[model samples]
Target: MTLYTFFGCLLTAYGPILSIFFLFIAKNAQHVLLTVASIAIQELFRWLYFLLMQRAEPGLNMVTKYPRSPFNRIIFAFVAGYGYALTTSLVSYVPILVESLGPGILMVPSFPAASTFFDAAVTTSFFSLLHMAWMVIAFDGFAAKKWVGSLKIGWVLASHLGASYSTLLNTSTIPFGCIYAMVIQIVFLLISVAIIVASLAKKR
Candidate 1:
């Protein structure tokens, strides 16, 4: 997942440059098309990055090693997810947000400042929680030596892509305020923390 985010950041840096070309040629729902294309590209890049990382660091395969407590898994997931989100927001979203502030760059719709912040906060928290879920499930499957473990990488990528697409689509319909988004993020964090605590207690 960390590798995924690193590749995502790289793509995010280049996305705008491509958007410039797309802006000139694309017509009718250009922004929407761009969003989908971006997600697809990111997923592809993420997969390739994962393969490269696995080759470079063979030890990563030991991710399934046993004796890893659920509490530790949860913490690792949350932290990794948060780190991904932070890098993504700072490296990817911030520039787009800035661009949006300008006279509506072609193919890039300008969002209100509040909307941008709300979107960022919500997306960061949502993906973080999603990562946590993925880690827990993947680890459990691996520890049990289930075939499901083999599918964890693909599952995480697919889920991330699906969630990103859905979130982009829903943004228009849901239209959350900053305060509401913040509250939701906080609630998710607290719930995840509670789950981690529960896991720790169970181990004890």
Candidate 2:
């Protein structure tokens, strides 16, 4: 039971991530490279990485954020998507995920059918998927040079804030707190999916 719980939570957390990468990124060489660099460069030369990205500001920045070709669009999206998903937010969770490898399964009282690890795993997967959507909408604004005035990106930002706030309810003190958090994230994720699909439709 203990090992089952551990692996169950482990797969729950990373399964979606693996699936998405395989479906969308693995086949694309550029995507695979960017994903690797996104995490690797940052870890290897933390200071130099930011310094260089800033230094590459003129050429690389414009190509990434205000890309002209369909290719550049993919470039920017990958940068933003992987950047947001694989950054500090991911690193911070690694240590805590050790909880998923437990001596016993820990259930959430307020949401008894779900274990705490499972709840956390679901939240993690949702964030990763949402980050992908966010990049698409955000790229629309950036490429259009409507950074401050883009309603689409603004909506994504607002949803992120609201989702973060809702996570506070992931506690026993609040009845159905975990349930509320899960529902909130699911709703946001659906909206994100719509945004991604809409963007893809526009491309087609």
Candidate 3:
């Protein structure tokens, strides 16, 4: 739970970190449609992955905003996701350091840039999956109780979508139609998938 809360804090604080990465890929491409599609896919996959891996539990279809039953489990999920995001954001600055301090500095554990792009991809994906997993876990009750009488998760969707587009704009300056760009996208997807797999394993 501590980690989850930390991630939530991180996401809120350095949300642009994600944008920056995505922008790099989106560089000079038709990111407008791709951005929308990517986010849509991300959201869909979050739920689908959860369903495929969900464990047998005593509960309704989903959670409510304000739970009538014990909400500890849901709280834990949210906190866990938030914590992962927060921690990642805190450490995200290390990559810049790695580039600045030169390759020699990357050898030091104290400098987070020592971590590779694969490491970052895995971490970010894990954080996002956990965040969504918790949401599903928490919202199962709201889903059961129609707790969305006032609160709407749509806002989250909107925020993510907006951020994706904004980041796409930032990325548009770079040349996206290139071998390196394609390789990067492929690697990113692979790392992200690995993260999702890792998170799902945790459920077991």
Candidate 4:
């Protein structure tokens, strides 16, 4: 979880800069594309995070030392997701908060609108939770020595892109889009939990 937090901070700190670089290079890059890229980068970081964790402490590998209960997996996923959300917000928004207090220092273009910060944070948090839930499912499959179907990168990417796009739309002019997005995310989370439970039952 601590490692996840650290990686979240790194993303929060550097993500905007990378986006700006893309903007300058692509000349006609759409904001939506950049948003998708950002989410994809986060997912990649998640993969790297688990890889490092598995390497640094083999016992920490969920694939080998799987949690015995579905509830435990849910709890672990929630905690990890919450940590990522909190650290990501702290590193990304606190600077903006400080800037709002006085003169702005960080000059990253295309920052999220101040009006949508609350909505974006809420959406991001819930989406992060869903992402972590999927991770748990993926890891559980691996722990069962079934790597073929463990990773669903496309599903993960699509869900994140959907969430981010929804948030962005809400930020623009679409009213209540964030609420709809949250509902979709909640449904996804429930489905993931149900899948995890089923997987645990089968294993037992």
Candidate 3 residue 73 Cα shift, in angstroms, is: 3.5
What TM-score against the true fold does each predicted structure earn? 0.39, 0.74, 0.32, 0.50
Runs with alpha carbons beyond 4 Å of true place in candidate 3: 1-43, 49-54, 59-69, 79-94, 103-151, 168-204
Q: Could you list the CA RMSD of all candidates, in the order they appear? A: 14.0, 5.2, 16.9, 13.6
lDDT (0-100) at residue 14 of candidate 1?
39
Error of 3 at 2 (Å): 31
Compared with the true structure, what per-residue lDDT tens digits does model 1 show for residues 1-204? 243443454354434433433563233243233223333223235434333333533343244344344443433333333333334545645554454444432321233443343355345545545544544433333333355445555555555555555545333534443345445444544554554455457656
lDDT by residue for model 3 (95-197), tens = 5323433333222222233233323433444445434343444334234335441132453344344433432322233442222333443443344345335
Clashing pairs for model 2 are none
* Segments of candidate 2 deviating more than 4 angstroms: 40-80, 145-149
What digit string (tens of lDDT, one per residue) describes model 2 on residues 44-85?
Answer: 343344344445545654534344554455354655466556
Model 4, 61-180: lDDT tens digits are 343234344344333333343344444545655553433334332221233333333444455456555654656654454344444344444445566666556555454445555566
Pairs that clash in candidate 1:
none
Worst 10 residues of 1 by lDDT: 104-113
What value does the lDDT take at residue 55 in candidate 1? 56
**Candidate 4, clashing residue pairs?**
none
**Global fold similarity of model 1 (TM-score):** 0.39
Residue 112 CA error for candidate 3 (Å)?
25
